[model samples]
Target: MLSAAATPAQLSAQAASGEAGLERSERAAEEQQADNIIVTGRAQKLYRVETTASTKLPTEPLLSSQNVSVITSELIQDQGARDAQDIYRNISGVSFFSYAGVTARGFRQEEIFFDGLRGDPYAGFSVPQLFNLDRVEFLKGPSGMLYGPGAPGGLFNYVTKKPQDKPFSADVRGIVGNADRIGGSAEVNSSLGGGFAARGGLFYEDRGLFRFNAASRTLIADGGVSWSPGPVTVILQATRYDQELDASRLRGVPTDDDGNFLADRRWNHNEPGDFLNLRSDVLQARIEAEPLPGLTLDATMRYNDATEVQNYHEPRGLFDSDGDGIRDATIREFRDQRRDEESWSFGGNAVYAFDLGGDVGNRVLAGFDHFNGEEIFAGRSLRGRNRVVAGLPSPLSLLDPVYGQSDPATYNQGPFSIFNTDSRRTGFYLLNELTVGPVIITGGIRQDNFHDDSDGIVFEDEATTYRGGIVYRVTDEISLFGHYATSFEPQDPSVQNPLAGGPFAPTAGDIFEGGIKTALMGGRIQSSLSAYQIRRRNILQVDPRGDVGNDGVDDFVAFGEVTSKGIEFDLAADITPDWVLTVAYAHNDTKITGDNGGGGILNRVGDRFANAPKHQLGIWTRYQIPDIGIAAAFGGDYVSEQVSLSGQPVRPFMIFDTSLIYEVGPIRAMLRVDNLFDKTYAVSGFIDRTGHFPGEPRSIFLEVGYAF
Candidate 1:
């Protein structure tokens, strides 16, 4: 460990970060100097330093990256960010937009990583607790180059927290707040044997939110081991998570005045949704070695599997045209749905660095990576065998008040399947980084070979991608850069044969961006501003009825085009030795530059994409009083109205949160208030009786912990 002798520049930086108070600032500086390598915001020689946010670029940055955000462990802890949704919502250019749902962005489809290894996508969404996480990296672009196929929105990588050599330490906390909620988390770090260390973390939370009726229970456990021998190091990790939720909503009779949602009574109840019960398991292993002084190699593999069950009621009379309320035209009031999915990924990369021979002060670094992924998704629905009239006297509605009635229908006895799908993909890449004096340039080429073979049908194709970037250090205080990148997304399995009996082909897009990075106040304060333009062609849009029905067969076609231009700003500073503040904001103009919506060729064309908010902003602040052993944090987010898939407006919303902490000896206590302002917001839901999904309401949690 390095000693506590800080440089004058370091001291000045700390002073500026703590501009909120001089005494606190100076004291913080003294403490930082005492803890070398802790406050520098730079890692030791063991690894290169990466700025956690795209706004702040470290000396050595990821090549050809338009924008990236790194959420460090330090920041997560200080701000008490609970999950991936919290991280994304607090960042600019992003919104939760119904992040609470299982199929939403951060919850289900987002790409993720553990350490440097690829993780199973099916299990990514099931990760309810963030235990043993070192950092969360958000690469804001199509990461098909390094990672594999995913959303065009971006990708998220979770760096697992590793074992430290500092003997042993532990922390325990308890939280309580809104909707009769309570939760806690515990972590332990220790050393085992010859060059071996281990760490484990466990978390549990239960809470009910302010909705017509909704509640959740979650439990997660994660552990990892690190082994180093000679010039090689290996790390292994595993995690298990389980969750159950009572998801209540009105499916039809769905809209209220102003096109809002009142409730659906189709299934004999005021609120008739379903119960979501899920369980997931994941395992990952990674190895890194140095064959030579300046050469390194990395390899990783991961697997994940999960199961889900949903129980809901479907009213046949609601949508059935003949509309008879009795047995002749009746539909079952109870349905059982189950889904299972598995994912596996593997990849390897080699990086070499060498000095250029001369006074040019230049160096060259190069690497290559390959990755593959596979998935299986299945869903089944079952109906009961009883029936009840609206005015009938039956206990089915009274016994299970949520669904109202559960008696099986007379005819559709066994089960009726709705949807099922399976897919697999392979990706590979080559990348290079060059540095000369104060300028660095990077270039990369990647190819993706994706094949979608579903239930005897096969769709296969390949595409190549390229990226380039240049960064110049104008001065120690300012850095300027520009970047260009491309992405390719294939058509969905639901695409049908319009002519000749073949599926519609995939589409592509390109993005261009430019930005400036600055470190002021001796590096204590960091700020970044960026502008970008994205153009997409041959886009696919779903039809009405929320399905791609091609005469009972799903149908799809390449639409026209779309363009989005936006500006993003992020700022972070140590306002005082005791206070840290962060701010992020984004403004975007997204429109269908060209389309065939008039011809019914596109449904989403000319309609703002679902979940894309025009504006988003967030702020967070924290302060600590060492002498008093007290600390506090405040933060929240605001988002503008969003356009739904049907061209309807989802109202804008805002939320606030705060927390307080006190320490005594080795034990620490914390009290947190979520949705502090009790803002009535809907993270995800439909308007005009589409069925509203209310966001989490005001809640509180009190936790206790001990650090050994």
Candidate 2:
């Protein structure tokens, strides 16, 4: 065992001393060649040395002016992260609004990208499968200069695994867990000879829920081929994903007036026959060329088609029929919905690098992108309906419940509602970076033209955004940086205001950020500390004189503003050869700063945003026993209390996770446990006082894999 009192500098010096001695011994040998023997080592640090997601250029994290988090494949495997939310625990100020929605820096984020291309907003419901992904990158703060027309909070980019030039390799894995969950995956990669390479992967899972009668099954398959005949390289990729769930998975357990949970955590009020199914198919092609020594050009195109079908019978809320305070009955509703969506995007960029005098270098990139998408939805709902059992009671008893007795077909369907929306956007951007002495200056600007048409109502808007940043290197291992950026997101087409006499304009946001980054212990430790403030304008506000409960064309006005400010600290270190640690923390404050007289109940000027927590912390550590080929890790997450839109309190909670792994030759085994304490808490909730989504209970998973 190593001494716990050893400082990072001391450990680094010791490692250096050992390496020096080994080199000396090799030099003194007369009969043996010193270069013939090589030593290979491994570390547990999760920090990535370089990333391109932030600047669209290969740059070191310490030299970038933005706060970025990179979750590598090793960390994902070690933690057994099943979805994006699972990996977000290590990133501060990022939380879940619902299974399909996420909140970052106090603002709701509905945009997700794949390989820098935009994806459908509802894609979150499918929960991306990570089996064929290389890594997940989070670029925080305003990103409009690169992505164009997105939430100011941040964006998540999923990097797909590409074909590699290597000998034939294959791996197969199987997993079994609690709640009757079972899963398996297989991956294969190889070179096809004659400058051609190919890779393929398949994943399948049948997951059970803690709530009664709730379950999901998913299947995902992806394949890619790359050809490198000359200086130019071309790649083609395709993927198919499908998911089916027993219900909508939105129902939550109700709480009493005192903000205390009243029902059992495992109780589910959704009908057994309720179902939701989703299917998506994607195709992509990319080409890269280096026609000149310092000039490179790349182009990419992607097309995606998806469909969603749902039939649900959901519990509205508990009601007091006799005017008493005690709730005696549960009200339910039914919905039958179907949607079809299709999207396509094509983009390319040209980068040129040049040198200016001594110690000065510069690079510039110019790109243009266009995207088009459409969604057609049809649905009908029946509200205020009684339970399926007739003559027994109008509503089911809240205290004593009997499930699987409801018949969805017996409910009278209401008037059918249908809508079709089509959207198109085109953007052109330019980015430039200059390095002089120890300083780096970066600047970018983008112009976007957006158009949306819904039910014969058309809206058109355009915006120009910009970003500027500077990074000053104090030493080879430390840097200080600051940045200013602007962003915009278009309002929903359905939102309109009588005062404006037209559709609402897009919301605009601006941010100012500063940070310090360091790479210590000979690149064994990486850390960053940052602070930022963001403000958004032109938010929609409810009209005071309009019919509050009626769905009128002019019930909302665009005259509101919000502010979010926060501080974040992150660190990843390989303290020693056998010990690794990662830590992150964030403190955030968000409030409505300006609201017109038409503000709604939750839009008070001083109220905090819903589902935005004030504090978040996470810590993870791992120790390896090389002799036994075993490693163990422990981690925990903490989130402060949050409130609903109506200011209803949701209590805070903390959960712990642990994992153990054993590896030998070509075989590996792992055991993981989540929510070890079995804490009961609410993950999210609705503002209608219906119920809160309950967190998962303690669960265990065992996985085994083999590589050949």
Candidate 3:
């Protein structure tokens, strides 16, 4: 831990995390239970957290220069959040872009972190499971200095549940809803004595969507064991996750120019046979030792294997063969994709805390990480990552859709390349934090070396990023911080067209940010006010040259620059010990500022990023009356209008949700209702050329659980 003055964030979480917090939590079950619906106190912090998931020096969040937003396990349970999308409303400046994809800080983000690992175990389109996880942390801005190549908009880091060295504790839950929702889960954690502990969980759910012919089923099995002896600790864990999206890739309903659905709200073009599936297995091991009084060493390793399969329909467009102004028919293409991916990652870091003299201290961290990954992808159609083989397209009526008109067996499956590619990276990083009196200064640097091979075509590259920041303790209740950071990302080797600046420079981004954190109302309310400007260079866009093949789709190029500037405010408070509230607001403006060559008004200067709203707000509040074992939670999310890639308008929308809870002894129950007004809205505007993704109209789910 770095030597620094105490801040409000630290004061709020000093009693809620790690080993020391565990001991404090056991005695404050009734107090923390105000946020934890399970009643039994979970060691991990619920509403407030003190530190980030750092392998280096640990510092309080408010004092840290980076901007990070967290979603604790307690928040997930209180909202009855079923998946990743459900919790997006709790964070500011986050909106849906596509399947398992989000627009964060005006950039479409896809990559994520599992624990301290940089790679995602699940496939791109696969939705992540939340049951086996402890919390989600969003780190904003360029992180290349710490994690490796990625988008500048930032990434999500998920912390998994670990074995707790305490008395035996178990929880079981069952859920039911109106829309074919039936789910259950069981979890157990216990101390095996002799410095040994174990934890395990099983979760299964089968749920239907608001749209017709769309549904999902998921199963997850996870377990872990840890042994702590003297000054050393070792942990081993394994997880298996399986999910099936039936009648999958339900992009959206066919809509007219005015955003009115030409078909029913629940319309779906896919047949019952179409599906998207994913299966992943992962193993992880770690060891930590404190051999000296002020020195710590940690090492971790992970092995992951995952397979994803997709069989879905892609809507070509609605057309009137007769050239009539009114279109009634649509063209559909069948797509088949299968991929198997594997990766191995190893990392080690050491931190040493020493004092320059009295009242002054410094902590230095040095680490190295290596990753090796391989992928095998196969597709039946040339459109989806295939070296050869072309598929056929079928037609359907927009007014009266017919199913089972297309078959994958008819497509030519010959001469397809399944040996996709192999990639590797190695990173060496260092960080230093120096504390002098009331001021702290920090700096970090990382050098990443990348090697990739696609079908024997090999490419090697390297990038070095840097970060510097300062935090000044003005008073015990307020702190001011500022930072400047730079990030880098490697481009896809396949997009090497000369017209679009093929073999172009890799993407680079930078940010200048400042913030003030304050503790008000006698340290009960904590708030942060911040502003930042982020710029992305070497962004991929449409090529100025017309489509040589006249495929009606413009080609892609890499010669664009974008800038996003935003102001955000967040507040979390414990109002009177029985009530808690969190509020978030953001205003972001993203524009295409530079373009070398552009045509047809696409990817041109001044164009806004698609599906990114300029304004967003979220509020959540929970209150409990301890005397009666009853509590209530109410929350809502608001997002402004946005422009789609096709130059269509995505209207603004607001949704409100509420939950009613009843707890007595070890039994707990909750009734959650989402979209209370059944408003008609779109989750994504013009997500594709011919449709807009419809939002869930209304939903109600009931949960019952027992814990001891």
Instruction: Determine the backbone clash count of candidate 3.
Output: 0
lDDT for 364 (candidate 1): 34
Candidates ranked by lDDT: 3, 2, 1
For residues 237-276, write the lDDT of model 1, one tens digit per residue.
Answer: 7888787766532232233333353332222322234566
What's the lDDT for all of these models? 0.57, 0.74, 0.75
- Candidate with maximal lDDT: 3
TM-scores vs. true structure, each candidate:
0.81, 0.91, 0.90
Winner of 1 and 3 under lDDT: 3
Candidate 3 runs further than 4 Å off: 1-45, 54-56, 321-324, 382-393, 406-419, 497-502, 521-523, 540-559, 599-606, 686-690
Residues 102-172, model 3: lDDT tens digits: 88889888887787785577778887878988888777888888888888887788888989889999999
Kindly report which residue stretches of model 2 are placed more than 4 angstroms away from their true locations once superposed. 1-46, 121-124, 321-324, 386-398, 497-500, 545-555, 601-606
Local error of candidate 1 at residue 424 (angstroms): 2.8
Worst 10 residues of 2 by lDDT: 1-10
- Residue-wise C-alpha lDDT for candidate 2, range 517-602, written one tens digit per residue: 77665556666778999998888766666665455444676787888999987766777666777777888998877878656523
